[model samples]
Target: MTNDAVLHTEGLTRRFGGLVANNNIAIQIHRGQLHAVLGPNGAGKSTMINLLSGDLRPSTGHIFFDGQDISGFSADRRSRMGIGRSYQKTNIFPTFTVFENCRLAAQSREPHPARIFSNALSYRTVCEAAERAIELAGLAHRAQRHANTLSHGEQRQLEVAMVLATSPNVLLLDEPLAGMGAEESARMVELLQRITPDHGILLVEHDMDAVFAVAKVVTVMVNGEVLESGSPEQIRGSAQVQVAYLGAEDEHHG
Candidate 1:
């Protein structure tokens, strides 16, 4: 593993009965880098993310986080260990104020639960963390508004803020730009770039433009295995990638 790697996997494989979903997938997420994973449907991209997030145990392999082998850790355990994840769906509480949603996320990191009689927001640390996260996500102005009132783009940003509240060093984001219009997609791309310097990000996205714009490295998968992994420039120039993924899209449009 690289010294700066915040998370890495070695020979990660997952099987479901007779089917192999992910095969010998070894990837690395280093600090201050954005690694984007691209694959056709059924390429096992989601499975790889699930395995890294501890949502599913790998059939064979190892996951290391911050230099510790945590393959056996549960999802909750991984979250507490500074691995934060955002789903493909928006997971915020609709009725809560934006601030409240982030505050609750920050509160989850409290080592000791506050007394039941005490107010949840009265915890200074949690409140401050929440405030910082909202600002980082560019939602400070909307902090007092209810979550349901925000646009779809803002809601997605809120979810990321909630994850940020957990103080994670690694962020696993699944298709954050899904369903966004051109403007929303641009903002989301900007947000991803802004946050990349501070976290090791593993982004699974279908938007080729956004991925190429923000990813420091790109890994392409096909038929449950990696076809190529390289910088955006290298990926764009690869004949293998074009034949397997990129050119297929072009041919379809043609």
Candidate 2:
């Protein structure tokens, strides 16, 4: 593993009965870089993130985070170790106000996340962290509104903010721009670019345009295997990539 790598996977594999969801995959994410995983549906992108986040144990192989072996850690444990994730689907408390949601997530980063009735409002540090998250996610104006009331894009942003509240050094973003208008997607790209200087982001997205625009390094996966990893320019020009993944439509758009 490279000293600069914050996350590393070695021969990672996951199997469900007869189905091999992930097959001997190896990945490395350098600290403070935006690494993108691109593939078609059912190419095991989500499965890969799940393994990295400790949501699922690998059938074989190991995972390391910040130079620590974390293959056996639980999801919660991984979160405490600076691994945070934003789901492809919006995962936020629907009834909770935006501020309340952020506060709750921020509180989870604390040693105690289940301290009910402890008056999180009185915890200046938690409150301040929540406020910063809200501002970063561009939800400060809607901080008082319920999470479900926000538009699809705003909800996605809130989910990201909620994850950020955990103060993670490495963030796993599963399709951060999944459901959004073009304008919303543009705004999300801008937001992601702004946050890159502060954290390492591993992104799983289908939007080739967005992937090409934001990612300094792109990993192309096909049929549960990584076909190539390179800079956007190299990927765009590679004959193997064009034959294996980037079809004619992708070239036309480019």
Candidate 3:
């Protein structure tokens, strides 16, 4: 693993009974870069994400965060250590305003034990973090809107903002563009581009066009193993990658 990598895996593997979900996978996520994982269904993309996020312990191998071994850490522990994750499904408070939703996410980091009954607005640090996250996610204009009232794309943006509110340096995003129209996808693409300068992002996405557009590095997995790992151009040019995955996408688009 590179010494400078914010997050890197060393021979990461996960097994369930006789089935191996992920196998001897080693990947790196560097600061200020977008590393995307691509593959067909059941290729272990989600399993890898879960393992990195600490939702599932690796059956073998190690996960390093900022050069420290974090293979034994729990999901919440990892989050507090500057690793934030966004799920495929929208996880937000529909009844809360965008700011309120973000604020709640921020509050998770510093739940004032001394002021358990205090008004949430009284927490300056939490509020500021929430505001910063909303801005970073490009949802400042919608800060006052109710979450349920936002469009599908905006909801996705809100989910990202919620993760940002935790003030993480590394982000694990799972299928962030799963449901969206062309315009909404474009907006999300722009948002991702804007944020890539600061955080190390590990994205699991099926939208090949969007993945190729923003990712600085791409890792293709097949049958729970890495088929290729390289730049977008290299991935596009790889006959192995085309045969395993991109060929099917090309056929669908062609």
Candidate 4:
């Protein structure tokens, strides 16, 4: 177990009857670094996230988070234990203000989340976490606006803000740049850059440009197995990655 790594997995495997979604996967994520996972559809990217987030239990493997073995933990337990994630589909309270949404997320991690009778602001810790998350996610200026009023990009940022409010050490972001314009993509990338110093960001994205721009390490998967994992430059020049993934795209375009 490396003290520096916030998250690590050994032989992380998940099987569904005859199908093996994730196979003997070993990976490590250290804080202050962004790790990107790239793969085509059916390459087990989603399974990896599910396993790490405790949304799906591994069939055969071990998961360690911050030096604790948490493979048996549940999704909510993992969230409370500082594993945060944003889904591919937008998940926000459309009618709520940005601050309210963040405050709700912050409250979820609190020991007194069920204290409904008390004033929400009285939970100073939750309030502070929410405010800090809003600032970090670049939604401070829009804190008072309803969530549905924000653009698609800002909504994406809000998703991250909500996760940050939980005070998570690991962030599993799935396709954050899925539906965004050039400016929005740039802003999200910048936000990721600013936040990398705090958490071990596990990004599963199809956007190669974004992956290369922000990722310190890259892992490529094929057919539910890792074909290669290395620095961004090495991944870019790898013949295996080219043939299994990038080259396929290039040839299709050609």
- Candidate number achieving the greatest TM-score relative to the actual structure: 2
Q: How many residue pairs clash in each candidate?
A: 0, 0, 0, 0
lDDT of each: 0.91, 0.88, 0.92, 0.90
* Deviation of model 1 at 83, angstroms: 0.4
- What's the candidate order when arranged by decreasing lDDT? 3, 1, 4, 2
TM-score of each: 0.92, 0.93, 0.92, 0.92
CA shift of 114, model 1, Å = 4.5
List runs of model 3 lying over 4 Å from the truth.
none
Task: Give the Cα error of residue 23 in candidate 4, in Å.
Answer: 1.0
Tell me the tens digit of each residue's lDDT in model 3 across 195-243: 8999999999999889999999999999999999999999999999999
- Residue-wise lDDT of candidate 1 within 1-254, one digit each (tens)? 45457899989999999889999998989999999999998999989989999999999999999889999999999999899998878989999999999998998899456488888877999999999999877789999999999999889888888998998889999887887768767877887898899999999999998999999999999987989999999999999999999999989889
State which candidate, 3 or 4, has the greater TM-score.
Answer: 3
Query: Could you tell me the TM-score of candidate 3?
Result: 0.92
- Segments in model 4 whose C-alpha atoms lie over 4 Å from true places: 1-4, 114-116
Cα misplacement distance, residue 57 of candidate 3 (Å): 1.2
